[model samples]
Target: MSFDIVERSLNDGTPVELYTFTRSAQVFRYTSADEDVLYQGATFTAVPLSRPSFEQSQDPGRKPISLKASSGLGFVQQYIASPPTDSISLIIRRFHTEDNTTEAVISWMGRVTNVKFESNQVEIQCEPIFTSMKRPGLRRLYQTTCPHLLYGPECKFSKPTFQLDAAVNITGGTTLTAASIGGEADGFYTGGMVEWTNAGVIDKRFILTHTGSGITINLPFEGMVNGDSVRIFPGCDHVLSTCVDKFSNEVNYGGFPFIPTKNPFSGTPIF
Candidate 1:
């Protein structure tokens, strides 16, 4: 035999309704004075009232019963409704103020349409709207070592990569275009492609000013378009190198670069 139970705690003078199932052989338990009794589960039908409260007269269709308490109190009223089905619907409403003004009377409705008795789960559906606004420059974006937004000791990964898509604009300093976009895990400087002039390489920098916007540096690579994306691949044992800032200036490896060999068995071999 299996059963389900729902318990609600209320402050003094709060009105509530108790709905239950019939075949389950349920029970009602309450202890508190100054409590106004409404419907009792003596019979499997709706009970009549001489002078109904505001909540009772509102819902005349589903025939919901009510209980009103005066002082701080608690009560439990249990009764049987219908048998279990794949879905059930519940509606809830609220008032805006204590005066019960027609203009000030705000009501809300919510429904719990589904329940899984075996798993002790429920699904509630509702429609409500809320909004908020804020000024610019109030938010700062940071890329952390973990996808879970963890930092410092909590971050287990050795190196984390972050990419900026837009062309960073600065006011005063020179423009430092990256050979490749993205910052290293441990290095102070970010690496980017610089123009190879006959004399030497020219470095770029950016400095902010009150009158003008930031400076912009254009990259020379074909695929490295403006606003193009970049990614950081963290170091992993047997996967990524753990040298951290070791590759900051090193672009190509090995003094003598090796070229790929052609397939020897591609054409017919001479005897």
Candidate 2:
């Protein structure tokens, strides 16, 4: 595939305009109105071109030159010495492929003095660029109909123990936050915590621990959420905080180093 220059113009007599094809390839020819021209193939190899060098070539009353090249895989020839302020005309030719496909070629023409050949190709330099992270859609199983546990003073320490079962397949680091539905007032209970145990392990010691005080969970790489169930041991009273209060720490509540809420029925305490 290649592109060709189909038209040319001048803007404010400073920058020369060359309209080239966006797709395919073709050859472009340039003709001068005045002065004889000598042609030469660039001796340099593929050196990159820079934008700054072209800006310095804007001068009035200088020798005018033109360039021509084949549309696809063709040589570029440069002309030297013509009318200083004269505009050049060009003709573009497209080549056809063996598969009956026609391709347009693109060519860039600037003042011969403005053109620079570092090696054979134009060189480009750029600064570092930044990108944003992409997140996947939330996974749903069992039609989102699972029951939730509520932790608050109203339930006291006499309520029945609640259980939660969740299975998550983690490809990278992930976080999971869960809370009670609506047994107590909104944001009335302390967030729950997670204690993880590897599958098939006989020991009861948790492998990883996470706090639910913020109702937010963060899982690191190689993280697994198998058929895990959180068993809330009853006979324990607790409190929850609002999303805002949890972040700002506005109140002077001193519930740290969790203390078990007193049982209303048994008059005993569980932590």
Task: Give the Cα error of residue 202 in candidate 2, in Å.
Answer: 8.8
Clashes of 1: 17
In candidate 2, where is summed lDDT lowest over 10 consecutive residues? 123-132
Error of 2 at 251 (Å): 24
TM-score of model number 1: 0.15
Give the per-residue lDDT of model 1 (tens digit) for 110-210.
22222222222222222221111223553433322112211124233233343233343222224323334334232223222222211121222222111
TM-scores, all models, native as reference: 0.15, 0.18
Strongest candidate by lDDT: 2
lDDT of 1: 0.25
User: What is the overall TM-score of model 2 with all chains considered together?
Assistant: 0.18
Candidate 2: which stretches are off by over 4 Å? 1-160, 169-172, 177-190, 199-215, 218-271
Residue 92 in model 1: lDDT: 28
